[model samples]
Target: MSNNVLFDVPGPRARRTSRIASIVTSVVIVGGLFYLYLALEAPRVTANGTETPGMFDPTRWDVITDGRMWNAILVRGLLLGTLKMAAVAAVFALLIGVIFSFARTARSKWIRIPAAVLLDFFRGMPVLLLMLFILLIIGPGAYWAGVAGLAIYNGAVIGEALRSGIQSLPKGQRESGLAIGLTPVQTRLIVEFPQAFRQMLPIIIAQLVVLLKDTSLAYIIAYPELLNIGLRQLPTTYGNRYFFTFFFIVLIVYLTVNLLLSWVARIVARRTASGRKTRRTGPTAGKDEKVGVDTAAMNAVMPDSS
Candidate 1:
């Protein structure tokens, strides 16, 4: 009945319904996970006289009488390769982002538009197709094709991400730096980028989430990332265990990485906010000012005061 629309509240029955829905959702999610676990260990039947169970067995982990396929495929093959590729990608993307972000935000028309066009050309291109093209041109190898592909596309996107963050900073910050007689580049490097980077931490993390998932595409070019490894270990009887392998390895990694990043971002944001509070409380509160007022000189100064 209140005039303010914000006063609207849910009734008791609605709260009960919400709780009921939450319980149902939780049950479904748990059940799905359990079912997938069962499917992963669902007995791999082979052709002719040989039978290889295509699943990870926890209880009999030591009894790997055959090949350590899980170790080969999932560990040394996919997991390590992914981490390596992602690390390389992050560094390259960071470099690209810095260059593009600076160029885009620069006052020079000649630099900004052209740089923008180049970034757009790369970013707009399909990630998978672009990687494949590079693979064909550059020849196949983990570092050459796999990591290179990750770097090219991710870096292009990261460049734009950085530029967006820089743009979102308060306009007054840049203007103030300029008004204080700082040069354009000085203003950006010293004032704009630091604050902007802090504020854009959240979005940068979100982009990382995208980067994490895109690693799966490496499988297409035989890059032997986690998914690629998982596929190789697929049971003949369980041909479409992609749902399990991918969900367990890929999505698990994605969620875990994103969550960890989010936690780090939250900590950084809290620290940044605390820093702002301290700055606002009084930047010069601690130091004693050196007032060089000699007593003898003060007597002479008092005579001149009249």
Candidate 2:
């Protein structure tokens, strides 16, 4: 009685087999996790006859629970430092990205070629190396060095994202704009870029997550970002016995920020997709608007004029 034919419905035996396989996989995963916990939770004997704490040790976690230590240093200082640096970098990166993208798409070979080379060069360089180099060029503890490094590297990446988005647009778009007597520059600016940005919004935001995480690299330059602060506290707080615990805290912070960015990207993607669908299905939004033309002479010259 059913018309569905794309994929055959699984039989009872097949369902049972899948259930068994899933159960086995779950058991294996749980067993592996328990083994990992046992391994990392093992404590070491220190030189002073005291047992050095491992990841699961309660003493190592007191800093996170101590209200004064946690709120005053980690929350107020280091995290704010990280966010401030990332915010500055993100802003400049976006601006630079737009400029470089325009340059890459320019009419002149002189502009496009150099823009392409610069984009490729920065994109090819490791972000850490750039940060280190910039720090050396500037000075230790100069916050703007981290900002400049992140912006330049990520700006190039973002430029490529925008460029690819623009290039992915239908050729007919460019052709029709030209057919309408618009110059190439005018066509790209007025007709193509808006749609291209909508298409590339998700990718651009994902790049921003990378930029946020890369802010941790500021630690190497001795800027008081989250990771540096955590590492600095590691010696006194945990006596260097709980390296993994401190790192795990930093990892959680990075993960939470990136997760939030991804959530925002998803929301934006949904809205953009729905808007595109509406434009496709509904009346074309101003795209069909045309100036009125005079009809008096044509009507008079016509054989069947009203």
Candidate 3:
């Protein structure tokens, strides 16, 4: 039996009951879907003289493969506009996050207090308000306002994540570095930060997920991001009828990007874990070199006797 950290595995009766429940749930879901299909179709299931299409109309689905439509919408709005903003915002956010996190953790209260206040204020504030504030400050129609808004807000969140990661490390780590004659700043930058970063990498990636999704808020300031593109195209190109099909494409793109990022995070986490394991095992490998050095010293000392 495999041991799970969270919960115990079900026994025979419990497993059987679970299986039965799942089967029942599946039947109910299928029945409900079939009922919905009938309901949607019944309205226009007839050869009514109306020109309007029904919910399950095959003609509506044809829009999914409209290459010309999707090409224009996706290329500019999704790839160029949305992705570009997310990339710029993410980079700036990560940089600001790291800088402020360092400041928040600094020995000096002057630096730490301001950093803390800044992080707390931005993090607690609504992203919409932040976007509006930046837009007002920088004037409207400027793309940088949107990017700056996202960066500042997400940066505060990311900084908190970093600060928590640093704080979660054992006190012994800091003490050990100090005992080795390193100053507090050096100890933090050298010994503590690297390990904390490794430990907090998953959290950092999760925060990036939030940041990516938050890019949609840029649309409030008329920034032509993914959601804004969808909004503009919805009324102009297809109207409200094809709304689902249009946004479905956007959903797929978001899912693809975030899934790719998650995959990268997993790969990095594995590499870091393996690296730590190798470091832990390195001393044993060095023992063999120590033996070779002792043998060479013994041979040199006994050379005259030979």
Candidate 4:
């Protein structure tokens, strides 16, 4: 049996139990899905005394084959509404994250304390409630309300992640910056922030994914985002018979976009890691020189120490 550090390696009996559990869970899930399929295939009747086709019926999904429907849902709803809002919110969130991260990491207690309190407040507030609050104040503009809410909340989250990344670095990194005759602010800006951002990139991307999905919440404020268009507008424009079809499409779009973001994050992280490894072990591996920090630049700006 192989040993493991995180937990004990399963013995024969434990392995058997695990297999049994896995089989049982799989059976339950398949059975549930089968039941749902049958339910959808069953016939339904409408209030107008007319028989309606089941969800699985081919005719009910024919709307998806229409070009106009695609244009309305994909282009207008998804591109113009959801993606646009997410893109804008993401930019603002990143800017806010940088500002808050700096304030949180500042030497002054006055600045750091207030930033901490504001960060906590934003992080603690529910996203939907925040949107609603913004909606009330903004008065009928769901887009800006949703954007502001998402930016503020996700900004606070990203800020904390960045701060943690910076703090997790070895003390020698900061000391080396100081030894090179760099001011604390200059060192932090030039040396520490870039490394911290790279370290925390995965977390930041994950939060942005969350922000993208949260755009659906704007539906509550009457914004014509993906969910709103699919659920309300399309059903009314075409017919309620295609509700599940629209819903399935919306779900798939959300999943696809988020998965793409996760994939991009993985690729970026891998490249950054490889670049760092190369810097440490390239042709100058044994040279007594700083691999990343530019000491000469710091010295040029500082007074010569006799």
Which structure among the candidates has the greatest TM-score?
4
Q: After best superposition, candidate 1 residue 98: deviation in angstroms?
A: 0.4
Best by lDDT: 4
Please provide, for model 4 over 9-76, each residue's C-alpha lDDT reduced to its tens digit, 9 standing for 90 to 100: 88899999989999999999999999999999888887998988888899888887899989888898
Regions of candidate 4 where Cα sits further than 4 Å from its true position? 1-28, 45-49, 272-306
lDDT of 2 at 172: 75
lDDT of 3 by residue, 84-144 (tens): 8888988998889888779999988999998888877887788778888878876755478
Model 3 misplaced regions, further than 4 Å: 1-17, 38-51, 140-142, 172-184, 267-306
> What is the per-residue lDDT of model 2 for residues 1-306, given as tens digits with 9 covering 90 to 100?
563475589889988998999999999999999999988788878799998766787876765776765553467545677888989999999989888889999889999999999888888788888888877876645588889999998888777777776766667788999999999989998988877777667667777878888888888777888887766755465567556666787777777877888899889878876776676565654544321111342222121111
Q: Model 1, 1-306: lDDT tens per residue?
A: 564576547689877998999999999999999898788767766667565554664433332333565575457655686766777777776777778889887788999999889887877677777787777877766456756666777666666656766765556778999999999889999998886666545445556556666777777777767666655544332355343543465556556765786687667657766765665467554334221122342232122111
Against the true structure, what is each candidate's TM-score? 0.65, 0.80, 0.77, 0.81
Give the Cα error of residue 212 in candidate 1, in Å.
2.3
Q: How large is the C-alpha RMSD of every model relative to the true structure?
A: 14.7, 12.3, 13.3, 8.9
Q: Looking at model 3, report the run of 10 residues with the lowest lDDT sum.
A: 297-306
lDDT of each: 0.65, 0.75, 0.73, 0.83
Query: Which 10-residue window in model 4 sums to the lowest lDDT?
Result: 297-306
